[model samples]
Target: MQEVGSAGTIAVARRPEHRGRSLYTQALFRLLTQKPMGVLGLAIVVVLVVAAIGAPWMAPADPNALASGAKLEGPSLSHPFGTDNLGRDVFSRVVFGARISMTIGLVAVITSTVISVAIGVLSGFFGGVVDLLFQRLIDALIAFPGLVLILAMVAIFADTDLPGLPEEGAISTPTVVLMGTIGFLLGVGGSRIIRSAVLSVRASTYVEAAQSLGAGDLRLMRTHILPNVLPPTITLATLGLGTAILLEATLSFLGLGVPPNIATWGGMLNREARSWMTEAPWLALFPGLALSLAVFGFNMLGDALRDVLDPRLRT
Candidate 1:
């Protein structure tokens, strides 16, 4: 390309050989290269996902099937993680439990992200009365201890029968309710982070310029605010994944989560496992290790993503 200089001389401009990589691509590259922990975290997450997806084929035995003759047997080639008190294969149950934990965590994070973004964007963009009302509501929700609030909500709705809903399926009513409650609580609290991001974007010169150009509130928000706020929101959602999984486990351990019949890591650690833990340590050890690894992996990944995605933190 040629451009005329101030002195009327022609100058040549050369286009780059290739286009720059996308933000996410660059972030991924950095995650793989610069962050060792992030790579390990991602690996763990992938393994868990694979385990959950392949549970049917990979599990050596039916997770719920009882083998009275093999009850509480120690680890061996037949059962890598040994048998539980009910003679259920601990390894099989752990693999199956991954499905439950991953599904609930993902659903809860997605739900919380939607709620947080909606509330945060509206409340922050429209300030004044709208902000006040939303903030007050958020405050009320935040005032209570999160776990206690969730416990109360779950307890109240646990036995409430819903017509036309199947008692058993890919997801049960009780499980759905549990996920929603966790999502709602996390979302309301997480809104504060999004709201702060929106406020920062709202005060930017570009936002004022957009407004000066006769852009509507919705247009400004969609074109400018939303894009800017997404980085923080994504980071928040990633971090929320670990929290959601841990919270589900806690609820299950307390006997307030999914049904006892269903296999879950937390349920595995319940009364039977606790009682037999001294006698057969593998019962708690394997499930606890799985839970710890899952939460650790997500948390590490989230931290790495936050560092990579945040402009302020970017190198």
Candidate 2:
């Protein structure tokens, strides 16, 4: 009897480990057999992530450096992407901009995931007055026009410490404020989808068995419900990455993100493209292309993830 109990304990302990291995193996196999679009999307996302992480090493020169007489210079051997209105290296700035853009996407997705998951789990699991109140609240928040809400939040927080975060810290200034505002809105909007997924998962036999076996609500939620909801949330996040970046760019273009002195893709267009589109079309072209490519990469990756997560779409 003692040996049998020990064996049962070991099997239980190994259960999660085995599940993790199976999931990893399945994901790897699916990636290996992924379609061309999936492969291309994966490549683009990998490249962008690398560029964002290695901007300092990859940049040719100081992205903010202003060379004498370099302003409005067309693309050439020295500066492949040409010089901007401030004579800064456009190529270097663009490379550095990848860091800002990708960071915005990541922060947005993380914030969205956390808030959405909490709201979704509560709403789906409780299913009473709690769910009714939250559902209405979420709906009301989603009813507002996003752009106006973003702009309003930016204006309201313009004078606060939210935008003036120090160079080195957990906070990232204006972006933190921006991301939080956007993330909250997105979280509320996305909670409904996750709630639906949670509802489906709650009805599964495994969940019923776990509950009957005396698993607490928190344990069941963290272990069973959360994991099942993650795939769809991840897919939402991948798609949201592109959306977040685009929104961030728009804010920067309107002089709301970072500082004007900082080298952001949208800020470059706002500062240089406005005055020098004819003189140096490359100023807008390259940055615009980068933004487009970033969005395209995320969207394609989201499509690939959808196919992988849903067996019916695996053709």
Candidate 3:
């Protein structure tokens, strides 16, 4: 009888430890051990992030500085990816463009996650009045057509210069704010997804036990509810990255993103879109390729993460 009692106590102690290791960690380990493609995608994303963050230092040539003699040059040992119409090295601009692309994606995803998670959590946990009001608001937001909404936001906010009037080619605060705002709006779906999960989990055995034990709403929500929702939330966040990147690119393509001088992949595509397929295909091809690769990288990573983080997928 004493041994059985001791075993029960040990099992109780270990339960917290077991729950501490989220499904995400197990999924991650499974991917690393069993799936090589997921690892490759993750590696590519990391490299791109590093390159984007270190653009000024890592790039061999000035991305913006004109090379009058090198204009329209083809790919060669001297200039690997060749030069664009204005003599800016295509390779260097593409490298720097990675920064622009990634900044928008990462920032937008983070903003979206924060807003969505907060709204979703409050609605799902508290329910009643809070949930009713929030759900209505979300429904209203969703009523607007997606592309039209983004276009309307860009048209309203687009400008030739930053608000405080920093010199040309500097980081554009207004543009970033606009992109981040759009990102947050788009990210609202994440919260709704989490809210649904929360609704289901709120009635689960452990949650009811926590409530019965007199845990405060905050404690029950944060300690018991939030942790359970994190794995799927992370997966959504990862997938949302690809969506945000695509939106930014589309906005840029429509001339609604970034300033004229900034050279994001979308910006470059817009600039070079005129006659590139006929005259200089490389101009359009390179940036388009970069954008595709960025989207591809995030999507692949997200898929792998989903497989890894999703509890249902685990054997």
Candidate 4:
């Protein structure tokens, strides 16, 4: 009898671990075999990540260096993407821009996910007054036009100084402002998705059983509700990454994101690219292509993740 009881305890302990491994394995298999777009998206994402990390080594020339003799040159053996009006290498600038875009996408998504998860878990778990108040706040934020709100916020904080930070810190003031604004906007809107997921989990039999067994609210949330809600939360974060990157590009194009010295995809287009489009089309073409590919990859991956992670959509 003692041996049987010990074996039963061991089995129960290993069950969750086995289940987790199985789920991950299934998701991987489906992502690789069932979703062609997912595979393509993953490839594009991997390439961009590698390009961003290896910009210094991959780029042949300095992105900002003036090559007076190479001004307005078209694509050639010497300059694959050609030179801009200012004589800077278009390919090098595009390569370096990948770093900025990826950074903003990753940082904004992380910030928004944290906010969405915290607010959503609390609002859904604690219903009544807490839920009502949180919902009202979310509604207020939703009332504003997202792009307009972000533009206004960026304009307001564009010149704000960050005290005690060095002039050459990895993250600058404008980057912080952009990340915070984008994160806040996406986070509040995304909370509704998370809240709905939590509401469903909250009503489940397991949750009710745990409550009946004297599980505290924190334990119920941390141990049960949070885990169940992670699928949708991850899906939301994945989708939001593309949105954040596009928003940053838009802001930069408008001359309201990052510093002028930084070479962003949108900034590349916004600078002399617009005026020289008829003469030097490569200036705009390459940057625009990179931006489009990045957004498309993220969107495809997010859609595939949603289908894989959401049981309702699974085959």
Question: TM-score for each prediction?
Answer: 0.91, 0.89, 0.88, 0.92
Number of the candidate with higher TM-score, 1 or 2: 1
Regions of model 2 farther than 4 Å from truth: 1-19, 162-164, 167-172
Candidate 2 local accuracy as lDDT? 0.81
Q: Candidate 1: which stretches are off by over 4 Å?
A: 1-21, 168-170
Weakest 10 consecutive residues of candidate 3 by summed lDDT:
9-18
Assess candidate 4 and give its TM-score to the true structure: 0.92
- How far residue 171's Cα lies from its native spot in candidate 3, in Å, is 3.3
Candidate 4 lDDT over residue span 108-216, tens digit each:
9999999999999999989999999999999988998989988887778766777764443337877887898899888999999999999998887667766765779
What lDDT is obtained when candidate 3 is compared to the true structure? 0.75
Comparing 1 and 4 by TM-score, which wins?
A: 4
Best by TM-score: 4
Model 1 accuracy (lDDT, Cα):
0.86
Error of 1 at 314 (Å): 2.8
lDDT, model 2, position 135: 95
Global lDDT of each candidate: 0.86, 0.81, 0.75, 0.85
Models sorted by lDDT, best on top = 1, 4, 2, 3
**Model 2 residue 217 lDDT?**
94
Q: Residue 281 CA error for candidate 4 (Å)?
A: 0.6
2 or 4, greater by lDDT = 4
Error of 1 at 38 (Å): 1.2
Candidate 4, run of 10 with poorest lDDT:
9-18
